[model samples]
Target: MLTLPQLRALYPEAPAAHLTAFAAEAARLLPAHGLAANRQRCHFFLAQLGHESGGLQLRTENLAYSAARLMQVWPSRFPTPEAARRLAFSPEALAEAVYGGRMGNDRPGDGYRYRGRGYIQITGRETYRALGRLCGLPLEEEPGLADDPAHAVTIACAYWSWKRLNPLCDAGDYAGLTRRINGGLTGLQDRYGWLERAQRCIPWPEAGSEALPLPRLRAVQRALKARGFYDGSIDGIIGRRSLAAIATLRAELGLPGEGLDAPLLAALAA
Candidate 1:
């Protein structure tokens, strides 16, 4: 039941420098469309940057694609030899070509999987279709956002606007975005839950506050807290209060829920 101001107050002070700057920008740019936490996208983007860019920029001599890790073959990665030469000069753009479908993350030829690139990690041909609709660009035709950091982030923001796909987004309403952005309920958000849990026992931003120590981070936290299944305040930090309440609810459902992440989204979506 925490207001944005209250929720924000719980944020632990974080050092600024790397992600802090991006958080400010993400916060500033996101609210006009009504995304709640600046730290949310900032947090998500920084994590992606870590996975995509090796934390700073491309290694230059290295490539994400290889003969063994090949997913798709391209007749020409660049529009022309000149374009290829152009990419060769910049470590950044070369990474883009590789991630933007030109390079291929997963190469069945070499057993490589399709790992999308760019700040947001745009992967697979299907990803281009969704991102294209949101960003007003033909990702298929241009297919360059994977390496283009700014464009990748911009398109990701457009994708996270929420309820445009779900039509019911409010703060904590991750369902719609999760469903579409992840391409179904059990995609990115779902995997991230486990991976995030494994990484830190919970998904905390690199430099921000924590997810409510409450149960499944759905809008239901708001309602359940109101109903007492969640004694945790409705601030959405995914803390103990929320988790305990979720366990109780799952037992009541007789549905074999994990009481953690496995069936939380399904229970809520159901």
Candidate 2:
């Protein structure tokens, strides 16, 4: 449902290829993951995604830092300038020094090996193994796959789901969500800016409407088609084919009725 133009507006600095891939993947995966369930969820998800991925431009963590930068970023770890200078510009050494004994990085090279990747910057060996199981991908064995654009969104969505962060979004708890995602309030203002921009770009459903808007209906149609429950053209109209597809999906999920409601949307998304 997120248009290409809207995505471009959201991430003007992203490369054209990255924008295209992210747009397609978001359209397919966001709804499927229930991240697009409502305006709040969509805006919150995009805000965090934009902030974490640097507006969808970065798939891997940048460990290269100057001594002054290192001193500022990790003051507790590198208290003095001389200490920071030792690992300055040495990404692998810095990674090892800071991340070696934490986040399930016990092996010699596990620091760099399990460094952050993907849209949300998934980090750590334990996280990679867990997400790999959720996504059915060998992320722990081949961490670089998280850098691939196709897999990045999947990893992000899986991470979001695994963390069960949607309720915070539903509760409008941006600070709570940020803490869960970043372990702190880092870049909180920037995330709020993205959320404001997303709110302006993406419209919410009007109250008292039984049928979804055209764009959302089209998204549902696409989801149904992907699941082989619908074979009709995705014209955004709730025609016989669409209804039949919904009916079939409801039957499979053991859900009652053929109505378009929150439960149906959630089921289709699931």
Candidate 3:
């Protein structure tokens, strides 16, 4: 329902010229795996990218694209946090202070070299390590990539893909996406008073069409297979038998039988 005009209205400053170029590039890079970005989602991504890079002024924007290039020159190669911090951290002592202690929990501390991170800044060293693994980037190896917008955006894209953040389904409307992707509704209530008043990004699909689709369906099949519920195809289709298998898992897991859709998927993930 979000239109091109609506997209421009959200971030009027995004260069029309650059977006045209980016659209071409994105079309090339995406949809290879049915990962196409519709008009609104494209704007959603661009808005995030625009916000992160000071409206695209920072060279660090979309760091993953150039991380390998930067690493070729920077080459993290650390003997210790102390050695890495000397170059990457603001103060070696402070840097050591955060990550120096055995890491636990997710809250950001100034001690870690990559103090704040993620698409919208989920801070702390533990997050960096976890995100690195999820995205297949050696976050500890190149601590600087966190600050680079290019790497940051690529990491964002990778993170989105890693978790399959489809607004059309699974993400529990917008608040859930905010909680999961933006790290637990920290800024939503404060920023827009939208906590009590949730914003609608994508209308949750109706039943039938709302059935779990590929990759997600595949995950459900895999989980059921692991639990020894369904012995059917691992193909990404949720047929009637898949539902029965999931119903069995639901009864065992003590969850309400919500059949084969978002609620079930959410419970499965939980």
Index of the highest-TM-score prediction = 2
Cα lDDT of model 1 by residue, 1-270, tens digit = 112332122222212232343344554555654444444443333333333333424311244334322222232444444444444444344455555444333333211123445544555555666677777777755666445534544565565453253232222223333444444443334334422332342233445433322243547577556556876655444445766777778777776734344355456652
Residues 154-263 of candidate 2 have per-residue lDDT tens digits of: 88899999999988776555767888998876676677767776676666664432223446777999999999998998756566688788888888888875457678
- Among all windows of 10 consecutive residues in model 2, the one with the lowest summed lDDT is 206-215
Deviating ranges (above 4 Å) for candidate 2:
207-270
Best of the candidates, lDDT: 2
When 1 and 3 are scored with lDDT, the better candidate is 3
Worst 10 residues of 1 by lDDT: 6-15
Q: How well is each residue in 120-193 modelled by candidate 3, as lDDT tens digits?
A: 45345666677788757787667567655345545656656655566623322333444455544333323232
Clashing pairs in 2: none
Q: TM-score each candidate.
A: 0.37, 0.72, 0.40
Query: Considering lDDT, where higher is better, how would the candidates rank from best to worst?
Result: 2, 3, 1
Error of 2 at 207 (Å): 6.1
CA deviation > 4 Å runs, candidate 1? 1-28, 33-45, 56-115, 162-209, 212-246, 249-270
